[model samples]
Target: MREETFKKRKPKIVVIGGGTGLPVILKSLKEKDADITAIVTVADDGGSSGVLRRSFNAVPPGDLRNVLTALSEIPELQREIFQYRFKSDDRNLDGHTIGNLIISAMTDMHGNIYEAIQLLTKLMRVRGHVFPAAEEPLNLHAQYVDGSTQTGESKIPKKGKKIDKVSVTCVEKERPVKASRKVISAIMNADLVVLGPGSLFTSILPNIMIPDIGDALIETEAKVVYISNIMTQLGETEELNDADHVRVLHKHVGGKFVDIALTNIGIVPEDYIEQEINEEYLLQVEHDFKGLKAEVPMVISDDFLLLTEKSVYHNGEKVAEEIFKTAFNSQRKIKKYL
Candidate 1:
C-alpha cells in the first residue's frame, strides 16, 4: 500500500541535458521527491573524459558521474570523496577524477553503459534514474555556416563559426548504439519535460538529435519547457536572446514543440559579470518577452539568478520551484480531461 501510494504521488520529471548545469537542477529535483530521470549526453570529448574515452575506448563518464553525485542519497563527505581527483606525482593517476575511473571500470565490468549506470545507481543510492544519451561514446558532428564540418563536442564551440545544426554519430558503428529505450519511455511518461540550463548545442541538442529520441519528443503529450541559459555562451549562442534560443530549438526539431520557455529577469551585477567573462567566458543572457511570447505558448520570466563571489548562475531552488508549480498545474489540467 505504501509503495502504491508513493508511486501515485511522485511527479514524473525527465531532464535531458549534460554538463555542469544538469547536476545543479537535478540536486533540487531530488529534494522535491520527483520521480527523476536524467538523460545525460555521451558526446563529451574533453579533458579527462576525452582522455579516458580515447585510451580505454569507453563512453565519456564525466557528465554521468556528476549527475550520480547530485542524486545520490548519501552523506556529503562520501559524495565529495567519490568526486575527488588525484593530485599526485603518479602519471597514471594524476588529472583523473575518482568518479570517472569508477564509472569507466564499471562500464567495462557490465560490458555496456546502461547496465553500468544501473549497477552504480544501486551502490551509490541514487534517488533517481541516470541514463547516457547513447550507449557508446558519441561523436558530435556540427556543420558551420562557413560550410565546414566539425566533429567533437569540445571542438564545436572553439571553431568560432556559426553552427548550422548539430547531429550525433556513434563511435562504435558496429555496436548498434542509440539512445536507450528506457530514456524514450521516461519521456513518454513524464508530466513535465525540462530541456536545459546548459549549453544549447552540445549539451541539450545532442540528445534531441538522435532520430529515435527526436521522434518520441514530437509525439509525447508532456509539456516541453526550456530553461533559458542564464548567460549567452560566447561562441555557441552569442547575441541570442531568450526567444531566439527557443526558435533555434524549434528549428532543429522541425516543429513548434516547446510549450513553455523559462527565463531570468534579474539583472546580474556588472562586477560579477566581468569575472564571468574572464573565468567562465559567458555573458549575461538578454531576453525579448515579445519574441518569446509570440513563439512559445507560455513564457515565464523570474529571478532565477544566483549571484556568487566566483561566478553567476541559476538558483536551482528557484528554478525547481517554478518547475513544480508547472507540474501541479499540468496534472490538474490532465485530470479535467479524464
Candidate 2:
C-alpha cells in the first residue's frame, strides 16, 4: 500500500519559458499543487534589463523578476510593490522596475545567479523552484534562412527575416553557456516538462539551446508538453499555424520528439479580439492539428483561452489543472480488477 501511494505522488513538472506568458501558467500550476521548476531564459537583451546588463554586467533580471512574482506567496500588496515599474523620465530611473533592481542587487550580493534566486524565493515566499537557465547572461544568435546571422534577442525579430535556427552564447562573448546541474536534474527528475506559450524563438529556444539542457530534453524520461501560444506574434511567429510551431521547435532541437502539444482551440469572440488595438494579438492561432500530431508524438486541444481586460491569454489555472491530470495519468500505473 505504501508503495502504491508513493507511486501516486504529485506530478513533478518543469516549465520552460520566459516573458509575460510564463507567469500566467506558473501562477496556475502553483495553485494546482504540482512540483514546478521554472527554468527561465537569460537571453534577454532589451529595455531595463539591457541597460542594467551594460551598466553592471549582471544577468538580465526582468524575466526572473516576473517569474518570482508569479510564484510568490507574499500578499498582493508586497508582490505588487516588487512588480512596480517607474514611469519617470529621469535618466537614472526611467523604465526601471523595482523587481529588476532587486534582482540586480541580489545578483551582486551572492556573486552567483542561482544563489540569489534561492534567497529571493524565501523572501518572496515562493511556492516552488525557480532557476536561471544559465549562470551567466547569454546572447541569442539567430541564423536566418537567407544565410544571414544576427546576435541579440531584441534585434532578431526587427530584421524581418525568417529564422532558420537559433543558439545561445555568453553575453559579449563567444563561448556557449551550460545550465547548472540543478536545472538538468530538475528536468531529468520531472514527470512532465512543459515548453512555453511565449515567443518560441526568443523565450523557449534559449533555455533549450544550452548544450546540456538540450541533450536532457532528448534524453530525459519525462514527457514533454508544449503550450501553444493563443495568438500569433508578429515578427517571431507571424502567419504560422500550429503545425508550423511544432516544426520550428523540432527542427532546432534536431528531432520531432516533443511528446504533446497542448493547444488552445476555443474560438475567441471576434468582437472581443477586435476591441484591442494591437495588431499582433488580433488573429487567433491557425490550426493544422493533423500536421502537429504527425510531427509531435501527440496533440491535445482545449479551451485554454483567457481574456484579460485589454488582451487575451491562456487561463493558467486551467492549464495547470489539465497538465497536472495529464502528467499524473502518464506517470501512474493503473491496476485492473479481476
Candidate 3:
C-alpha cells in the first residue's frame, strides 16, 4: 500500500447491540473518525416496528431508526421528521412512528430493509455503515420465571417475570445475514471490538445468537470489550447486578466473555434515586467485579451518570472517552510484547 493510502485508512470498529445504547456509543465513536460498522439486532416486535413487521413482513425498523438518528449530521428538523409519530382516532394510524412507516415504504420500493437504510444513510450523510443481524423479521422467544413463554421482544419485558433465556425464531431457521463482506473484513483488520451498555438480553445478546455472527466475533483477532449498563431494566433485568449481567452474556455467547469489562461506578444522587423509585424503577446493584470470571479485568469510572430532570443515564461522550482510553492502553501493552 502507498504511504498516502496508509494515512487515509481509518481505524475499523465493530459495535454490536441494538436499542438506545448502541446508538449513543456510535454517536461518540463517529467523532473519533473510525470506520464504524454497527451490527444491530432486528427482533423488535413493538409499537410501530411490530405493526410493520407483522403486516408487511419487513425487518423491525425501530433499532434501525435509532442508528440512523445517531449517525445523522443533518439539521434537527430533518432528524425530528424522521422520528415523528402519527397519532389519530383512526385505528390505522394510532401508534405508528413516521420513521417506521417511511422505512417500511422504502423497503417495499427497494425490496430490502438493508437497501432502504443505505439510501437513508446516503441522504443523511451518516458517518458509518449499519447492518441488521438477520434479514428476516425475527421473533424473540423467552422462557419466563412463571414457567410460561413469551413470543415477542416487546412482550418479554412486560411479563414481569425473570427471563431464563432468550432465542430467535422465524417461520424457518434463518441464517445469520452475512455481514457486508466489508464488515467482516473490518473485523479481521480491527484493533478492538465493543459490546453493550444496552439491554443485555434484548439488545446485545441477540446479535451473537446468529450462528455465523457469533463465529465471526469468536474468530476475530480483535480485543473485545464490554461496556456495562448503568441501571437495571424494570422487567427483564430486574435485579441483575453488573456481574450477573456478564454471566448471562457469557451463557449466551458461550465462552467468549470479554477481555475487559468497563462499568460505571458513579453514585446517583438520592433525589434521582427517589425519582426512579417514584416511577417504579430501581437503580442497578453495585457490581461485584471480584466475583466475575477471573480472566477479565474490570475498569470503573465515576463519570458515568448523567443526571437530568427527566432521566438519569450514562453520558455517551464520557463513556466513549473511557473506552478509547482503555483500548489504547491495551494496545500499548500488546505492542510491548510484540
Query: What is candidate 1's TM-score against the reference?
Result: 0.93
Q: Report model 3's TM-score to 2 decimal places.
A: 0.88
Q: Point out the higher-scoring one by lDDT: 1 or 2.
A: 2
Candidate 2 colliding pairs: none
Against the hidden reference, what TM-scores do the models get?
0.93, 0.94, 0.88
Q: How do the candidates rank by lDDT, highest first?
A: 2, 1, 3
Q: Would you list the clashing residue pairs of candidate 1?
A: none
For candidate 2, write residues 209-324 as lDDT tens digits.
89888888988778899888988776688788888988888888887669999998988888887787666554788878888879877888889887778688898888888889
Candidate order (TM-score):
2, 1, 3
Worst 10 residues of 2 by lDDT: 329-338
Summed backbone clashes in each candidate are 0, 0, 0
lDDT of each: 0.86, 0.86, 0.74
Off by over 4 Å in 3: 1-9, 145-147, 173-186, 277-280, 293-295, 298-300, 326-338
